[model samples]
Target: MRLRLLVALMGVGAALLCAMPAASYAQSCEMKLGAMGPMSGGAAQWGLAMKSAAELAAAEVNAQGGVKIDGKQCKVVVVPYDSKYTADGAAAGSNALAAEDIHLIIGPVGSPEATGIKPVAARNGQLAWNAAYAKNSLEPKFPLMFHIAPGPAVWADAVIKRAEKEFPMKSVALIAPNDQGGTDIVSVDAEAYKANGIKTSEEYYQRGTTDFAPIVTRILASNPDVVDTASSPPGDAGVIIKQLRLAGFKGPIGRLGGPGTAEILRVAGGLDVVKNFYWFETVPTEDPKVQEIDSLYKKLLGKDPVGGTAVWADLPAARMTLKAVSLAGTDNAKAVAAELRKMPVDDPNIGKGYWTGKKQFGIAQELSFPFGIGIIKDGKNLGVERQPARPD
Candidate 1:
């Protein structure tokens, strides 16, 4: 009887040991979020900023004992990948992240790169927060994908409306890359200019066409009062601006997106050379909240913030996603997406944004954040001149 009782006790001990790790798993798990972008190529500045922003968000959440999910505190970790700003690179980088079991992917910013991540993200059941300025970035092709930027119509109504009041847009020359990107950008410009009683002449140039002499001359012959570089790639936009300046068009240089200030300065030798240029993307760093973010970013990344990019929006986007994780009560993609649909426009960086997309993309996943206007003076970033004003 004694031996049999001892044998039974040993059996119970084995069962307890087996149950131990299964219980502990709830206490020691980490939720991995992935970020991919061009950390090495021309868009490195933007990419690095994105990665840093995610890291900052993750750090803050982890410090607070992580995002509570499944009745457990799952620490969020941001894993970054460099996509080289190419479609192939984005696919490969995202695949690598999926292999590591990362569920939420942030970035792969811009055009073809942002487009390529859709399939990989969908296949892996990963939620993607696309921070690109591309036309198709917010398309409903991927049910799990979300856009955190404003749309073309939103910009046209705000940026262009403000431009009409500030600059002489009666005769504006619009130039962009001869691609789908240009089409989307110019489409907004056309509608906005027309609404504001401004006439616009649009000219498209093929990518890699280095000679802007003829293009600039044709643009000048039209005698435009404002030159719009809405969809020109960074390097090309800078080249066009420098050439336009050389050709003596003393009008305002403008974009609905960032004008690639570093590249523009590099190509044009600005900072006491170039005059007025306006952009629609910048953080109102004067606000104390933005100032804190700015200081933290500089300290964490060992670099100062760059204007005229999505640097301001990326951190806000991350914070918004994390907020949904808490409100959804679980980290499940669809549940978090549902909560995201109801997220408020409280992020100070991107003012007064709400989640709305059903009318535009057949899904309620786009964050309509207010965009700020930036003015460049004496070739230096003057920061935001005005915030986006939405119609009632």
Candidate 2:
């Protein structure tokens, strides 16, 4: 009777040992994803949006028992870095994250950061998505680099035409920081305006200059029918618009760059102060599906997402990257990039988009989503109108 009892106890111990491996395997597997952007400074909203998007995407995957890789589930961990909206900052951020064995990055929002991160990220075998309007936002040489959205070239003409219908303009002055971030977008904007039969003049200032009184005087001297804060950070644009109004310039203000209308309104003192305005919105923010993103973020992250529409625009890139990682069965940058190129550009919240940029960037790595043209006539918001995605 004693021998039989001992044998039964041994069999029970063996079964317990067999169950331990499955639990251990689940706990051991993890994937580290890097989120880089300017977490501070004037463009902080854009950067913060990128980080929030990455976090939300990770949370969604974690909810489903994490992402499947190599026949095991791996929990995705997002490591965020503040790249300071500068080229050097982004380059350093890439190397820093690479040291931690992170192979994918979701951010570095500005034009300078995009220019800064490409070569460094490539050398580190990292795949990075940038939401910059830089001329070189995507290039054939940087296979690992992808664009979050198309630059002004894709939608500038459509926006300009739409704005003309509401606010007629014969001449316009464009103001932005005197950097690649400003020049690349401003130059393209100028061409689009000219193409629409409007006269265009360009003005640029040092990025950190707070007092735009001098710049406002110069812009008003041009006596433009409309003044455009093309590609300026939302903070800088607000101050510029406030000064423009104070200096006795009463013309429609336009933004051909990024979206930050809510921030701009608060900074510029409100709708009454902004008066007539028109701009390019990266997404049709009024859509019920798009509005649901905030609720989803709150539910998953247990917090509100910052950066407004910018966060919604950045979410798809982060989600698709994780999907690619699962499809590749590894976090290897090259393998994941291969999968990304093959996958369709689709997002549940943002709906359908296209993979474009073959003609402009010589590579089809840019995500072209349905964008919107926003208008505010005489201090009352007229809302954003959805535009179809252009064919690649």
Candidate 3:
């Protein structure tokens, strides 16, 4: 009987041991988030900034004990890939990301690159937060692909409406690339200008058509009071601005998207040309919430911020995503995406006195955060001037 009791105790011990959970060697860190962009090519500046922003967000999240997903504390780790500013590369990277177990993916910086990844994002059950200006086709077709930037039409409408009040300009000349983003800006300009009784003089140029003298001569002949450049891709806009300056056309120029205006200011030899140029994208130092962000960014990056690029929005976007994921209690993509859709207009993360409208299918509510018309004055990047009357 004593031996039988001992054997019974041993069996119980074995059962207990078997029932206990095994020690997992797998890291309990947050599920990885993928970021794809041009980190190696001409657009490296934007891509590096994006990577920096994502890293900053990840650091902040990890410091706070990470985002909780499915009852586990999962640290957010950025898995960044450089697509080299090519469509085929972007598509392949996006496909690879779709195959990964990650729930969310952030970025393909350029609109063209973003375009390449859209289809893969739509079909693969992965959520993509694209850092590019809005395109119309993504909405009805690619519902899962979210844009973190304002739509081209909305941005253009705001610029034209504000221009009427700030500057007396009836005749406008538009110079844009032969791309979808540029074309969308032109389409929006046509409608907005028509509404405001302003005439639009159009100029369409290929991406690298460096010789803008002939075009500048014709644009000046039209005697435009304002020139709207929808050129992105950085280099193209820089060339256009230099040629325009050389042709002595000093009217107000509007940069619809990307780092064109800022790059022009850097290469134009002085801040003289920048003062006359207006950039419609969000700048890093514009809002108070960003002051803390800027402080941190400067601490890490050791440099000032640049405007007209989505890198400015990247960190904030990541923060928003992480916050929503934490609140939702899971890294489930659909759940997180739903929470993001309900983001409040008066979100504290945006800054003081800022408000956003209802979240759209294409963009996060934060992109609607007020934009500044940045200029380069005396060779220094200056913030907005002639600030619009804040909406009540």
Candidate 4:
């Protein structure tokens, strides 16, 4: 009886030992990162792209044994929130994510969301990167807020010059949503066009307006040489383009706003419909290194990334944020911000960039990368031309 009891006790001890590692692994360190944007609606592409970039970054870090936090390798888990491209939506999303103890956010992709998330994120001790072109995207008071890329103020003049050479225009009418997101970018674009000695007119419509026929009629009445969709969501821009064409306005169409050419093409009924188009491409996507981002995303995430060039533009921010988190040795937002500010603006895929925005935003937290100008002349895709980054 004593020998049998000893054997049973030994077996119990072995079972406990065998179960220990699995339990510990299950309870291992995990860092939750927040990714916010409009995951639905017309702006879904941009938001989804931000989420995809964050996931790819997290995957890349996890593959290398995860991020070292407090001496333990912590696996990153991305918690996404669809901000719905509104101010209140972003503010609420920040609070919701803060409740989950997530201190870093990948995006709130529009100007209104940027405006809304800033104060809430600051109060929550969160560091959020906003890809908004708002006039005040990064204020000195909100040091934790970071800009994903330089706004139109940085590249609009260059793009305008390139577009002017291709499609000479005397007067241009700019149309956008009647919100800060639209007004801010359109105002800057207007200035750029005016500076180029071109006459400019501004048109605004309420957000969520599907039919732009009335607005198109009003715009065509001016008989402008060009119509610039300055920062309208791609879906809205496509509809506007279609209506303008139907209204018998055959002038060149320019998009001096966000990068959404692919979506615009799909929504506007392809290249044939959007003939004589000129727009901005956030990166020199034609480069072999830049083009490699898609393959890398596929290899890391086991899926094709959406959002076209926007994903490539957003990836560096996510990658650098992870690097900062690892270096800071904590998920603390303030600590991560300090490390991020100190790190150089370098990405293997995007090449070198600058930490601009000191002059524009009163903070040097904006990433300025080499951009490109895409053209579709006479219904043929002319490809994107790479332009070097300008110094602040």
Query: Which runs in model 1 stand beyond 4 Å of their true positions?
Result: 1-27, 69-72, 133-135, 205-214, 259-267, 282-285, 298-309, 326-331, 348-351, 376-383, 388-392
Q: Which portions of model 2 miss their true places by more than 4 Å? A: 1-26
lDDT per residue, candidate 4, 252-325, as tens digits?
Answer: 99999998998888888889888999999889989999999899889978889987789999999999999999
In candidate 4, how many Å is residue 161 off? 0.6
Candidate 3 lDDT tens digits, 23-93? 22113754788877777643566666667777766666665567777777776778888876656767887
Q: Is candidate 2 or candidate 3 better by TM-score?
A: 2
Clashes of 4: 0
Candidate 2: tens digits of C-alpha lDDT, residues 267-325: 89999999999999898999999889999999988899998899999999999999999
Model 3 regions lying over 4 Å from their true place: 1-27, 40-45, 84-87, 137-141, 164-167, 208-214, 258-261, 298-309, 345-349, 352-367, 375-382, 385-392
Residue-level lDDT tens digits of model 1 in 1-392: 99999999999998987766332443477888787777864456667767877877776676666777877777787898988766777888778988997777777666667678888878877787776566567667788888766556666556666665556567788887665556667877777777878788898987556778988999989998888887666666778888998898988877765435656667666755557777666444445566577676666556665533456667777887787887876777778877877767677555675666676667766666555676675556676654653422
What TM-score number comes out for model 3? 0.77
Cα lDDT for residue 60, candidate 4 = 85
Given candidate 3, what's the lDDT at residue 390? 33
| lDDT (Cα atoms) of all candidates against the true structure | 0.71, 0.91, 0.64, 0.91
RMSD of 2: 3.4
- Stretches > 4 Å off in candidate 4: 1-27
**Model 3 poorest ten-residue lDDT run:** 352-361
